[model samples]
Target: MRPKMEFDPLAFFTPSLKEDSVFIQDDSLSVKAHVQIAIHQSVTSERVTSWHDDSCDECEEEEDALMPLHILDLPMLRLQPPYPVLVTILKLLSPDEVLNFEPSNRQQNANPDEEAIFREKAISSIHLKNALTWLNNSCPRLNASAKLSLVPHLSLALRANFTNEYNAYMTRIVSNELSWMSEAEKEEVQSLASMRISENCGRMAQPQLKRKIHLANLEKYGREYIYLNEPSMTNDNLGLKTWGSSLILGSRLLRVSTGSPFLKEPVLELGSGTGLVGMCCCLMGMVTTLTDLPQIVPNLQTNLKLNNLENYSCAELDWSAPGSSPVYGKSFSTVVVSDPVYSSQHPHWVVNMISLFLNDDINNNSVLIEVPLRPSFENERQLLWKLMSDQFVEVESEIEDGYDDFGEMKFCYKRFIRKI
Candidate 1:
């Protein structure tokens, strides 16, 4: 029989909140109810940096000389008490409950600095101590699985209050580096950790951010590919334009082709970094093969297993060599590649290799390739199109939109149908 787990709220909450007096005993409710209340309150009462103020003259003013002075856009109020303690209180407090409430008056609009301090104090004086007491006594059931999923929010709450205990907990979690766990478990932990790290360090701190190639949306949802390797593709070496465009085009193709006769078709991805596109294809019920340099295979495999995709395989393929064909066998009806045309010298070889896997009988096969419209690769893109036109007819060509932290941009996708 499985061991009977005791309720140990402190095991998870204490480490995240960094305070011993936060939980309280509760006789009135089940452990799950207490947890739900606590989480819901935390999510709902989260600090809002912006507030609505219709009474302010600035709302109605346009081109008025006093508009800037009348506006009351104060900086966000940082929580005074530890966020964990406050979250606990908000959960227990009734909707009608009021404690030390203070509204931002229009008269104080001109004094931004003074208004900021008042907002902070008002939010802090709400007294989270009682909430913490209830949580402690309730003894919620939180385990590794729950903790992993909650880490991102926990980290954010802890960092806001600058609690060393929570920081220590985060350090321990990352230090464990439990990469061997099942895909769901790994992602539960990784997603939280990645988000926390990204949040704490401003975007500029991560210079290689642009180079982090995500798998195409299709591969992500389809779960077709298992791994992505990019040894030469450092974040700094490549721009977001190339990576974003490739994923957009690849995802669009997969979205439109779902449930077609090609659903279960075997797919191969070249230069598969972070295996995003290929993984999406796998999830769509296709067998996927991801190829890149040997050094990147381990990380790629780790990501595949992290995303719960077990149907994909990975291998190394140096596109410039004539002997590289050993990695693949049997023709594929649909061959897919993204942003592979980096260097001008290799387009011909890459095109020739793509031709090898596509059936010569044009009526039954298709090839899909995505490339960016950069000045350096204009000639290479032309060469690839010319090579494909020799055997296959252009079936579809269009510019697709891609997403980024900033916004979205258009990308190019060209599909070729085999000609008889």
Candidate 2:
């Protein structure tokens, strides 16, 4: 069973992952996470140092105006209690939830009696004490000044929120090294960090069991299920987890299985990360071969077994060397892929891979594709389209609004009929 507690992003001062949190993995065990078919320069910006700066008086004043004016925005700003206790007392809520949230006097609720006000405060005090006791028991080392310096920055994070300062400040505390703690204390903190990444990035990297396959839309309904076990991230291995487009494509297959105009008959799911799309096709009574890189095949097999899909098969077809696979030169009615275009070379590689296995009968062959409309990969998406257009024409295409762990996003789905 999965643990009940993972890392909490907002208040990370306390360690809740475990007695020796599994989230704090040993540094030596890290895997090199490169993926076969998919794809940083560190740059330090020149700062406005006192020696280099020679801006005019007006510019200087404007800069000064941008600086935090109140004590609340600076290091001297005080929390009612000091050090570790302060965070618990303040409730550690987002500033928007805490600051200036109440409306005008006319819109206020009827004034509470002295008893009501006292009761609320008393209850809050009791909760705070209970939380503190838990914290002390869970983390004895936190009794010292370990978190003394965090109060001001947490305040600034709330005040400045999305500004450059806030991002920089947060990054400083959590990035490459936890700057606030000593080296001896880093491994403990890093465990939580690994278990709990801040936002969308963390969501993608964490091990997740996602129930994303649309059972409601399927014919088999509750009889068929997809349970994906995504493992923890290493470096660049994006294929371990099912991408958003896989769910999108799987749903599409289920929707059209009754009288699919686009399917060629037998299907080959290329880059079958987590085997979602191919398994969906097999469940629809289609012959399917799900293939990906050798490193990705084991997990593909796992997901296959998870859904009792052992009858269907998976093979390793390296996009860069498609002929090496057993499925090479074997024809399929449709060659399908979801979110496959990552590296710059992917466009040409994908086109070449399809040519070897996608049936040459132009009148009856097609490629079914669904990819996220990622802004960073706009060029790659366009290039893949252009390359596909040279050999295939779009038979059906639509842009659909969808969401994943990363929040709302747009995905492009298309059925491309092969041209002679």
Candidate 3:
């Protein structure tokens, strides 16, 4: 007799377990009919089981092939755009997987100019209404410094390409909020204003052309008695080119004069344009007085402030006119001027002015003048030199390099030491 098989419900339903033979629930009286029928069914069932096993084997092979793809062993997804897409992929990646995502050259070559133009247009159109909305909506979370950055960009847009609608808006914002700003914020606003003006002008933009002309005039007249003031305050091409040479020679003379143990006297700089030479004297510990026309006094003051020197004072003194005595009247140890002989009519007048201001004490008094050796002013320079020689026993002259905007020129310095 064949061994009896127990029925298993799970094995009967499962496709994998139907491979060998069919099992009967009861041993029937007729093995020919029931048992034969079961055997026939079992034979057919085994064929179906073999087909399912083959199908499962094919499926397992396909899944195994796709496993490497799920791990992203290839570089398909990385070659994409929109930074957020890359960020998302990066977040999904492990540290080692992230190392494989190299930046694509093609993606990097995408044009940003369109984006920039759009941003500029949008920022330019940000009017008062929008700015106020932005402030109301965003400012509570931002610090004062961050809030300050918004105004300057808006100011630039207003001054550059924006319509009056924007300017009026900016003006309102500034007028209302600027006073409440900290000192640093106020400075930032001032800087923005200056930057806007500079950007619009494309150069060092002066507020007034007339003021510039007046300042230039001061430089020209003041250059006669102050050596360093020539190139600094005046825009004269000749004066700037001759400056370097004058500085070298002037420096030598300054050393000789100041080296004297008994020469503890104040220096006076006439026509002290930007006050460069006079400032040099101050640096050497000499109290120096700077003078120019009335119109240039404010500019001179500004220059002095820029240099952070406290020992110098500016006054308006026309070399042609007799004036109130200066602070060190008749007591100035040194009187200095640079490029003062540019005009023919003014040479003699400058000489007379020098004569009047020189200390009567006579022992330690000296006048130093630096003039460019331009052909046009040669006669005037000679006349002034002669006048100085006549007034002082010791008159000396030297030639030095001069600085001009175009290049360099030879300049002359005439020194007159009064005889006791």
**Which candidate has the highest lDDT of all?**
2
User: What TM-score against the true fold does each predicted structure earn?
Assistant: 0.47, 0.54, 0.43
300-398 per-residue lDDT for model 1 (tens digits)? 676677677766777766565535544656566667777766555557666776777776654556777776664445676788788878877887888
Q: Where is the poorest 10-residue window by lDDT in model 1? A: 67-76
List the candidates ranked by lDDT, beginning with the highest.
Answer: 2, 1, 3
TM-score of 2: 0.54
RMSD of 3: 37.5
10 residues in a row with least lDDT, candidate 3:
94-103
* Per-residue lDDT over 1-420 for candidate 3, one digit per residue giving the tens place of the 0 to 100 score: 211223221221112222223222111111111111112211211111111123344445433221111112211222321222212222112111000011111112222243342233232323323333433443332112222222222222123223233234323333433444466745544444333333233112212211111111223233222312212223222222123333544455455545463334477777665556666666556677877655555666665665566667777776665455354254577788876655555677677777777776656688878876755456777887777777776467777764432223577776777755
Candidate 1, 365: how far from true, in Å? Answer: 1.3
Candidate 3 overall lDDT versus native: 0.42
Q: Residue pairs in steric clash, candidate 2?
A: 24-191
Judging by TM-score, tell me the better candidate of 2 and 3. 2
Model 2 C-alpha lDDT versus the unseen true structure: 0.54
Off by over 4 Å in 3: 1-250, 253-257, 261-264, 324-330
Best to worst by TM-score, what's the order?
A: 2, 1, 3
